[model samples]
Target: MADNSKARVRRLMPEDAAPYREIRLEALKLSSEAFGSSFEQEGSQPLDYFRETLAKTDVFGAFVEADLVGVAGFRRQAGTKQAHKGYLWGMYVRPVARGTGAGKSLVKAVLDHARERVELVQLAVVSDNEAAQRLYRSCGFVAYGHEVHSLKQGGRYYDELLMAVALTLPST
Candidate 1:
């Protein structure tokens, strides 16, 4: 296992597009069932598409020394009523960095960023992904609902568990 004790998390910039794209594509191809998007769909996109996405979304990367090992993204919900909520998406950690603390650090970074801006942070994990579910739960997320056949890939369906963490305390 890599020494992820030295792992650091930071918001990805436009200049980090190439590496981000590399890891993202790896994630989609290696764990196709974990995401709603497909490698085929995103792999065809140009580099500028990733650069623009980095410029727009709050994507965070975890680096052990100089190598990027993991990534997670957060985005504010659209519309007036949903403004108090934000979605956590596209979380991926390289296989080599799985047992290390990279995933937790990335999740913490997203939650910390979302703390000041939204009341709740939400995410959806494939129902069978126990490791990811435990990670989210350890970070204070609770499953609020479950969706059957939430994702379809290669003619198969995946159920998803909707989870969220409250960033703000309830008023007394």
Candidate 2:
């Protein structure tokens, strides 16, 4: 899809799972080093898993016409101690849509949706991913610290810089 025009950003529905999977798998394929999961890992997951995840999470998609251009989402961290924090993950925008505000919109939507329930939204971006780092920064995310040797994939290791954005409590 051409990226010159503004893309529409909206909350994801159950029907959007296939497109969501397609773009997400594409992202993982193009830059395996930048991702926490590999195509081999997520590709073979049952389609139901994608559908179920899409249905349950606070996810948003950016579409150019009907083509899904980008997506971002959050999942509540599992545990009584950490349940107040939502972890942002699997964010991607097509290369063509990178600077067209798609990423920002997708992320902002997820953050807005999570704000009522979670006080913190956590994420990790590879240290070398400047575009992603800048996008996250613009959304009020701050670095908590860096984790050396945080992930291992494809016979090589990678580090993901930890980040979080605090969500203001909903006004009474």
Candidate 3:
């Protein structure tokens, strides 16, 4: 296992789009049920699409000695009423980087960044994904709801747990 103590997390810039796309696609292909998007959907997109996405979303990358091993993204909810909420999406860590604290670091980076702009950060995890659910709980997220048959792939349905963490302290 790699030492994630030295792992660094930072916001991805447009110049890092290539590697970002690579890892994002790898994640989609490797764990198709974990994400809403698929390799076929994002893989066909041009580099400029990822560049634009990098510019628009707060995507954080976890790097271990210069190699990006994990990534997570944050995006504020659109529209006036929903502005107080943000979504944490596309979270993935390379298999080799698992259990090295990279996933935790990536979640931390997203939550830390979301703290400044939103009151709550939310994410969805497949109900069977116990490892990811544990990671989110460790990072302060709690399950607010569950959606049955939330995702359909390969003619099968996946239930999902909706989780959220409040970034702001309660008013005293």
User: Which candidate's lDDT is highest?
Assistant: 1
lDDT of 1 by residue, 28-109 (tens): 9999999999999999999999999999999999998889999999999999999999999999999999878899999999
> For candidate 3, lDDT tens digit of each residue in 1-172?
2325557999999999999999999999999999898899999999999999999889999999889999999999999999999999999999999888999988988888888888999999999999999999989999999999999999999999999999993465
Q: Summarize candidate 2's per-residue lDDT along 137-157 as a digit string, tens digits.
A: 988999998988787875777
Better of 1 and 3 by TM-score: 1
Q: What is the lDDT of residue 74 in candidate 2?
A: 76
Q: How high is each candidate's TM-score?
A: 0.95, 0.90, 0.94
Better of 2 and 3 by lDDT: 3
**Residue 156 of model 1: what lDDT?**
93
- Candidate 3 runs further than 4 Å off: 1-4, 169-172
Ranking by TM-score: 1, 3, 2
Kindly report which residue stretches of model 2 are placed more than 4 angstroms away from their true locations once superposed: 1-5
